[model samples]
Target: MTIYVLIAVMTLALVLLGSSVRVITQFERGVVFRFGRVRPGTRGPGLALIAPVADRLQKVNMQIITQPVPAQDGITRDNVTVRVDAVLYYRVVDPVRVAVDVQDYGSAVLQVAQASLRSIIGKSELDDLLSNRERLNQGLELMIDNPAVGWGVHIDRVEIKDVALPESMKRSMSRQAEAERERRSRVITADGELQASRKLAEAAEVMAEHPAALQLRLLQTVVEVAAEKNSTLVLPFPVELLRFLERATPPETTTAASTAATAPSESAPPTAPARTNGAVPAGRAVYPAAPDAAAVAHAVAER
Candidate 1:
């Protein structure tokens, strides 16, 4: 009967010892509650002892938590509707406040993050959300940290994951991008043409100042064409050469006999004078004999 009583007492002492001793990991802290009231200063790593019946230890993790915020639909400040989502990185700094100040710190942080994200969406434009996400993330972190600091949660960083646009908005942006590219391409082509025109004008001036340069260019063109080994080649004649030849040639003069035949006679009437042996009459004005058709044809052939 004494052995049985001793065994019962030893078993109860072992149970109490097991219940009172708590093990905290290196990344965890023990928040002690004494009779439903939180005690000051949290227990660190290693084994912790407390009164078995009057004390309770809650383990809180100190590791960073990665929480994904769900996509929210809202109208922006510019009156554009969009859907946005994000991710948050945070960790607990004070285990006591995390345990006593909030019923569930994780859930509270999530709720605050969602509310801050929605509020940021309402205050920002679609352009800022797409282009200036870094600024928006800082603002979101600040907003969420204000309420979360009281719960012993510190926001390390916030990142906007995705911003979804409607089909109409997507199409409009695509068209805008295409138009911008086309405008740039046209401007580049126009600039190229302007440069080519200026170079060609300069080349023309150079060739005009040095006539031999034109000849050299023609020779170069001929060489390039010959290098192609083509069966046919077309050569151009310069108009200046033709004008020079025309200027060098002398004008022709008419002979006296031919001129007298072509000019109207001032001394005689329309009727021919009476001739004797192919000679003009004595009183009529004497004129040189007109050249024969054979002689005129010979002169033209000689010319």
Candidate 2:
């Protein structure tokens, strides 16, 4: 009877010892709760011993945990509706607070991250969400870390994963971008044309001062056109060249040209005078006798 009692007592002690012993991994921390109340400090990695009946050991992972936040729908400050999602990286910094402060740190962090994401989306514009994610991410991290710090969770990083825009908003943005690009192209082309016109005006003034330059340009144009091997070649006659030739003519040649222009052609033709009622009208003949032309003729015949 004494031997059987000793064996029963030894078996009970072995079971208690096994239950009290715990193996903690290097990436985990052991938290102990005694009488339903948390202990002062946490246990580090490795073997831990606790009172089997009064003590409970909870292991909190110290390694970084990646939690994906679900997509949240919200309206932006600009009155644009959008859907946004994110990812959070976190880890337990204080095992005591993690075990005592929050019921489930992982779920708590995930909820906090989602709320923060929605709040950020509401406060920011659509442009900021799409183009300024770095600032938004920093803001999100700060927001999550503020509440998480009390729970013994450290926010390693927070990042916005994707933003879904409405189809109408997307089309509007595309048209706006296209219009801006077209406006820029038109402005650039106008500027180029203005510059080219100014350059052409300056070139024209220079060509006017130098007659030989104009000739050279004409000759160059001719050469270029001739190089195309076209059957028809047209040469431009400049009015300036004609003016230059006119100015260079001799004075005698100019006077003779004026005289020749005034002179009549020698085509032969004789004009005859007409007699009315078988008598010439007075003052009508080319050479008329004095006032009494008939009396003077009759006196000469009587003499």
Candidate 3:
């Protein structure tokens, strides 16, 4: 009986020791509480021992925790209603505080994250939520981290995952975007027209200074049109050709006009004797007096 009692006692002690010893992973920390009060600091990666029945050990993971915040509905500063969801990355920094300061750190962090998200949404506009996520994320991290710091939680990062707007708002945005694109297209087209007009004005100045360029341009246009193998081509008469013709004839015309104005007129003929219709007066026929041959010859020689 004495031998059996000794063996039982030894077995009970071994079992209690085994129960008190804990193997903590590298990514975890143990928070020890003695007599309902949290002990200082934290227990580490390998083995942790606690007093049986008089102490408690709570294992807190030190690894980064990825918690997805559910979609939250809120009105923005611009009075736009939207739903926003996010992802939170955090970890327990101080296990003693995490275990002692907060009843449930995970739940508290989640609540803080949700509240921070809603507050940020209320402070920002819809445009910022959609286009300025980086800023919003930083703000959210700060907001949540400030409250969570007291509970020994460190916010690694916060990211907005999705934002949903109303159907009408989406349609309105689509129309606005379309209008903006149309305005840009019209501006570009007008700019092109303005540039083309300036170039054409420059070309006109160049062509006016050099008339031969007009002829060459005309010929080039004809060639280009002909290359299309069209059956009918309407060729326009160049005004330059008319100008050339007028310049070529002016000198000769001026000389002829001057000569005609200086020449003397021929003398009038003497009237023949009155005669009956179809009857000839039988006598020597009187003739008209002609201009002097010497005067006519002098005028011709001067011309």
Model 1 Cα displacement at 185 (Å)? 0.7
- As a whole number from 0 to 100, the lDDT of residue 37 in candidate 1 is 93
TM-score of every model versus the real structure: 0.79, 0.75, 0.78
Q: Ranking under TM-score, best-scoring first?
A: 1, 3, 2
lDDT per residue (tens digit) for residues 1-303 in model 3: 999999999999999998799889999999888899888878889989999777888899899999999999999999999999999999988888887788999899999999999999999999999999999999999999998999999999999999999999999999999999999999999999999999999999999999889889988887888878864555444455456545544365777898899766668556555877977668756565434444444554575
**Candidate 3 Cα misplacement greater than 4 A, ranges:** 230-244, 248-303
Residue 205 in candidate 3 has what lDDT? 100
Query: Which pairs clash inside model 3?
Result: none
Which model is ahead, 1 or 3, in terms of TM-score?
Answer: 1
Best by lDDT: 1
Alpha-carbon runs more than 4 Å astray in model 1: 222-229, 234-303
Clashes of 3: 0
* lDDT of candidates 1 onward, in order: 0.89, 0.88, 0.88
Model 2, range 1-303, lDDT digits (tens) per residue? 999999999999999999999999999999899999888788888899999899999999999999999999999999999999999999989999988889999999999898999999999999999999999999999999999999999999999999999999999999999999999999999999999999999999999999889888987887888888864665344446455545654466766898999776678454455657888768765553223334444554575
C-alpha lDDT (0 to 100) for residue 122 of candidate 1: 100
* Residue 132 C-alpha lDDT in model 3: 95
